[model samples]
Target chain A: MADTEKKKVIKPIKNFSMEEYISSGHRACQGCAEVLAVRHVLKAIGPDMIMAMATGCMEIISSPYPLTSWNIPWIHVAFENAAAVASGVESGLKALRRKGRIPNKDVTIVAMGGDGGTTDIGFQALSGMIERGHKVIYVCVDNEAYMNTGIQRSSSTPIGATTTTSPTGKLEPEGKSTWKKDMVAIAAAHGIPYTATACPTFFTDLQKKIQKAKEVNGPSYIHILSVCPTGWRVPPNKAIEYGQLAVDTGVFPLYEVENGAWKLNRKPKELKPVSDYFKGQGRYRHLDERFTQQIQDKVTERWNKLVELCSEKPEK
Target chain B: MTKPMEQISWQEIEAGGVITEPGNASCYHTGTWRSQKPKYDENACIRCWRCYVMCPDAVISPDLEKNIFVWNYDYCKGCGICAYECPAKAIVMEED
Candidate 1:
């Protein structure tokens, strides 16, 4: 008789509290993936944390005057200074701890912002924060465009997508002409201890990455591909599906660069066509077949480069 | 639209970075925003709890006594994510 094969069982996290840190009554959109990402990230970090939120959709929705949804201590700073503020907080707390001003110094420091703030306006501050080796986690909730500012194109916006600023017309048929900025590569180039990409669709993967970022001793960068139903021109219900498709189609692959070592988190069994991800979005609805093919070629090239990076040995 | 500093009285001017009463957002009911509602079928539910886990609103809660999941509609914005992600097809979105 053949030996009985033992199946491996994957159990969920034990004693995971479903407590809500970001409570209801806040004015986020019905299908706002950015706020959802914040909720999940806060849950992973728990109560003993302070957030330095940049001026963006997350800040605007949560911190309207006299009303707030955040259960943790949160500070709202300028659009381009969340990282700078977080660095100050980290240093200030360290100083206070040394002077016996605070009893404990175990609290985590987090800085959050939208794609525009992260990849564009806040780039300099973020670079300084990482280079200074502050114990902080900088989370870029990349919804691909400036969703808070009425859907303007940002550096992170992908090519061939239509935004208010990058409108598709007779003159500019391809919409946004520039490719999406490689933010993960930028963070990795900073030589941070941990840098990762996550999406809300993969909850466990996202949570694990957040937890890992929290555990890192130095600066960590987490780029989350938050889905924007309103900006992306997809139905509210399709947010998760679109997020999943982004991963499956290699438009946004989930990976991490830890201590200069690259690792691919989720390799799709069979890569889906880029059209499968783009067809649902209204932003990409204006794309012709030729433009879509061009976008597909770009995605394939980027994915190939990523795969090569993952397979290569890290330098000493 | 900018108001002159001299024209604005101290009493009328709003203070910045101060929340006297924190976490009072719960006092406000946002259920009026919901256009559709989630209907759960207890019989069809296989206790997978995918809807409970994936709800972005955190409105779904497991009823240990009843051995089922319940939706707190007071804050649910009717995103349909719960129904869309239900593995057992136990949750359905219906017009409210």
Candidate 2:
């Protein structure tokens, strides 16, 4: 019975690689979850991958002229063409293999970008890649703003968050007027073979999803919610804590869509209030009770909609 | 061995400024950024690897021989994520 019980209990993280793909000493901020997410993703994919990264936080931090943190083949592409470049690389690799120039082995092609690059700047290229059925994994390391350029607001920035461009004022107490763009939903709508929402706090889940995405033959999209301590106005130590709170509060539910089928990876029995999530973050400090309630209601409504969608057969 | 960033000239840089070396940023020390640093207490540690996974800078490594994790201060920015996430309270933050 003791042996059986021991076998039943499974650890969340186990047998992880000690090899660092995106090695230490890069210039990411203290407790930056975006870099951590990329690190874990690279570890999951191993060295057999080619990364086409857009101009964003990860690009800026990892590659600064004479040095790079990446241990794999990586290319720095323009802001709006990471996906396009990834597709091209995938095609090039295929041709190279066909011509016997390179060995016949799968080299997973990945395109990485920040929230601004994904939801705003590179949306067209991403859509085109997905539409053309390229076998590339597009990972959006979203800290929810243009953090590389001094924390300006992006489409992925949530409502009531005060960014540099969307500052709180006497006229507008709530920072951003618009809702955060649903990029995962948009990717799922494209009918990609795989699309998932991941967080660095859940490393095992994130790694599992990445491995799953690699196995799929068509396009895959993974939207990773990277907690930005500098921009979020939280203590650097509270980065992972905020990531946990975001999931517990249902502000950012973790889920995946595979071949038009929706699956919720994490489902809280009762979501903690949105105010609990906003209390420490500096970005949401200006939000009053009225705005807080509005956000809470919106979160609950969306959470319920997501649950319903996950339970039923999604329209193909 | 690569020269310091300032010492290297533009002509020495590869065509298109490609960095042939992988993970060469390990040369740059980021430990100077830390205002507070983490001190590990071996007796109280559980060896759960929470600190290993949570480290943003990837400075923590497992010392299997000693059955404990080690921190490489060369790149640790000292965000205290490991200290904060430690359930056993094995890691404490101290003034740098």
Candidate 3:
């Protein structure tokens, strides 16, 4: 009980304002993690920002025809052009400020998309945006699969998870046979000022990362691990729990690379077994014990490598 | 969820999804989707506030004056993550 009391004292819950930019009543699921992530992200970035959202869950659910959930200036383009559109918007604003058409260029530009749009279809646009040095924040809500498009497998999809494109049936028992694409590393590789991985389970951390990304001068990337109950075959109520398990298990460690310096934000004292994270999700139900062991080994290996990277001196 | 499209004038709609008026989506009540509602028991609560951090809907607002957590039922879909994550065993999910 004393330990529990200490825990309560350590994490004093701050009363964040009830005021929301992403208003209630769009078409997200009962426990949609991505929508929740977006809600917090908007809260962090505040109302003085404009957004370019890709054609995915966030766009479809938030802005459907006449009814819209956004309280900010939000633009929706094709799935692959969110970054490009954001770049154009940033340039347009700059041009407007230069010509004295606008009083000031104070609004922050944000490009948001699902993992499928960010890692697969929109990779080229994202690379171009980073390389060209646009003052914008790109948010990748990684729910592991293309959940909006009926749970199709994407490059960000983790290995051993069953999806529509990577079905585990009579022939294929392991589901998706490939590892998740490390988008944060790729973003860091572009010599960006900021790149971080965040999760909805840790709301404060996620909010802080978004705020930091907003403050950075050049292109910044925030890769958020959003849980999908519908696609992952977990109870809708288990969305936040699964996200916590992901972090605690070291499967998706929360960290940031600020100017090529790696930092591990939350390192669990004892990493939870990867099987504990997988057993609840139906996507990994078909996985045999041996396959689960393999996944465990892989997770441990990745975690060790990340720890080593964090320890080394950052390259100049 | 269906609104009369014909009733809306062309000038009323923005060209893109740019919401000129802020917080207009608050008008649409989405709490009707909840099956199980979370009931907070203050007596059993230790004020750990884990529920405040875990709630996806941001429906839990802390009332420092009252020393209790307030649930905004209008927006809360009652996913019960708050109840499940409550270390104090204070919040319980009840039939809506």
* Best model number under TM-score: 2
- TM-score for chain A in each prediction: 0.95, 0.95, 0.94
Error of 3 at A229 (Å): 1.1
Residue-level error in angstroms, candidate 2, position A305? 0.5
Give one digit per residue, the lDDT tens place, for model 3 in A1-316. Answer: 7885544332344634456777776768877888889988988888789899999988887765676777788888999999999999999999999999998848999999999899999999999999999999999999999898799999999999999999998777899998999999999999999999999889889998988998899999999999988899999878988999999999999999998899999999999998999987999999899999999999999999999999889766
Best by DockQ: 2
Error (Å) of candidate 3 at residue A238 is: 1.7
lDDT of 1 by residue, A62-134 (tens): 8666667778888999999999999999999999999998997599999999999899999999999999999
lDDT of candidate 2 over A39-85, digit per residue (tens): 89998998899999999999999988898888899999999999999
Two-chain complex of model 3, DockQ on C-alpha atoms against the true structure: 0.47
iRMS value of model 2? 3.7
Which residue runs does candidate 3 get wrong by more than 4 Å? A1-18, B1-20, B47-49, B62-67
Q: Give fnat of each prediction, in order.
A: 0.41, 0.76, 0.46
Q: Name the better of 1 and 2 by TM-score.
A: 2
Tens-digit per-residue lDDT, B10-92, candidate 1:
57535775654545566556677999998998867766656765677777887766666788888899999888887778788
Arrange candidates by lDDT, highest first: which order? 2, 3, 1
Q: Give model 3's docking category.
A: acceptable
Cα lDDT for residue B36, candidate 3: 95
Local distance difference test, each candidate = 0.86, 0.91, 0.86
